[model samples]
Target: MTEPYHIDTSSNWRRQAVEDWLFGLDHLSPGMREKVVTAWVSAWASSSHERLEDMPFSPGENPYRLMDHVNDVTRAGLDLGARAAADWKVEFDPEVLVPILILHDVDKPLIYGREGNAGVHAQLFHELPHGVIGGMLLKELGFAHTIVSTVATHATNAPFHGRNLEAHVLHYADLFAADHAFRQMGKTPLYLRHGR
Candidate 1:
């Protein structure tokens, strides 16, 4: 397998982290392991198309660009989730976690618009929450209820009642990836660098 794409590739630390998680998977039952791997492969393959127009881009931006961003965020979340799950000893079905990580941001393209900035992508669209949309998509694609539920609620930040450890990990991982990408592009928010 090719190295997974990440927004921060300056070092190999993330790769090592994922490897460590893979090693821990050996403790899972064979059936469970197979299910997780299958979900991972299916998610990756379904979302792998490089053309943005093929995705559900909004009005102005190239679909390809949007797809690239989605890919970056999704990969970041998956990597972080794996690392966090391993570190926390969270015993989740990898099948659920892996697909949830991959599909958490699937709503971005559908919400894209020319007017607003990135921060409002979720708010601007007003579709079902991205998490909810993700869950629905996963279900449409034949994923189980557990995977759908996890993906749909990953972003519940209000009461925090809707998230599990894996979902929270995915959310934070996405934030980290987005921050890193923006910084690399010289678009890092002022508050992030200087604590405004």
Candidate 2:
């Protein structure tokens, strides 16, 4: 395990996972980093509890924190996407794809939060999955339209016109990361274990 990040300000403990993940991205511009961090900060602020931002999708299912899962996906997605894209001669841009991977699950906190030992989850993202909510928040936070669309469609099963290729990359990348994270903990993800 890595040592905790040392934030210089008083509001240190809040959203440390998100901050640690964001600070690791040196490829992003200062403005972009700020925007990404701000999106998470806004999510945390919108909630009542402090730990909601770190909550996993389901304690019984997911084996890692939501932020950790997102990080793992992003970390794996970049390399995997690039390699796969290169082999297929597909155009893959990191600037466009990285943000989508990082922010794909930004709404997980809004969806599943452990409110005082109760199964308290948000219904605001009921009809609209976390991808749509996170995409909206990302757009309002000044991300590009393509980025928002990829994030939105990542969780949506149906296909749509004007959808960017990175959307599929992100969608599968998330699946790969989820399965890997679960397997790391000696658990099968979505029952993908061979022979059950």
Candidate 3:
């Protein structure tokens, strides 16, 4: 197990919000759960937004927030995992999938900001695509290789694809959630817009 990344979150509201999303996963070990909390805390602490919900899901004229997007992905990923397991007759590990789904966009807060503001962590936001810095952060924090790879490759334009069942499940779940958000915003879904 990796050493814990401890922080004083007694006053941080985001800590509770992060835990609310992460709690009650039967497959997520305590160690893994702490790592997820650490990731969210570390990212938000270094970010510009005062509230997690204040951060938008993507840049530009989108109304959706990062918190909402994360919730959508997590919920979608779990549902997809259950359905896929039933159909394929193979078990998917929530321990793996949940963390990857939760942390896949952990770097977004650093990369984006409230409208009209520059990226809070430009050092990383300007240097790499969406998932690279996030994956590297997880690695530096000693996340397992599978978890890191799944988070890293969950992006649509990532050069290397994740090679695990959890990664595949996360990819589709992410797309489904994104599509739902886009539809709610009255825009064409990426999958339908590009037909890719």
Quantify all predictions' global Cα lDDT against the true fold. Answer: 0.49, 0.65, 0.76
For residue 1, model 2's alpha carbon misses the true position, in angstroms, by 37
**Model 2: residues with Cα > 4 Å off, grouped in runs:** 1-17, 59-62, 115-120, 156-163, 181-188, 191-196
RMSD of every candidate to native, in Å, equals 10.8, 7.0, 4.4
Error at 153, model 2, angstroms: 1.4
67-144 in candidate 3: lDDT tens per residue? Answer: 788878888888888998999998976677788888888888777866563223444566678887688778877888
* Clashes found in each candidate (C-alpha, N, C closer than 3 A): 3, 0, 0
Candidate 1 collision pairs:
52-63, 52-64, 131-152
* lDDT tens readout by residue for model 1, 1-196: 2222112222244333332333234534566544434433333233433333344333333322444444565566567766766898766565556555555655454444334322224232464555665555456556677667766666634234245676676667666655655555556543376633
TM-scores for the candidates? 0.52, 0.75, 0.85
State the TM-score for model 3: 0.85
Superposed by TM-score, candidate 3 places the C-alpha of residue 123 at a distance from the truth, in angstroms, of: 6.1
Residue 180 lDDT (model 2):
73
TM-score between model 2 and native: 0.75
TM-score top scorer: 3
Models ranked on lDDT: 3, 2, 1
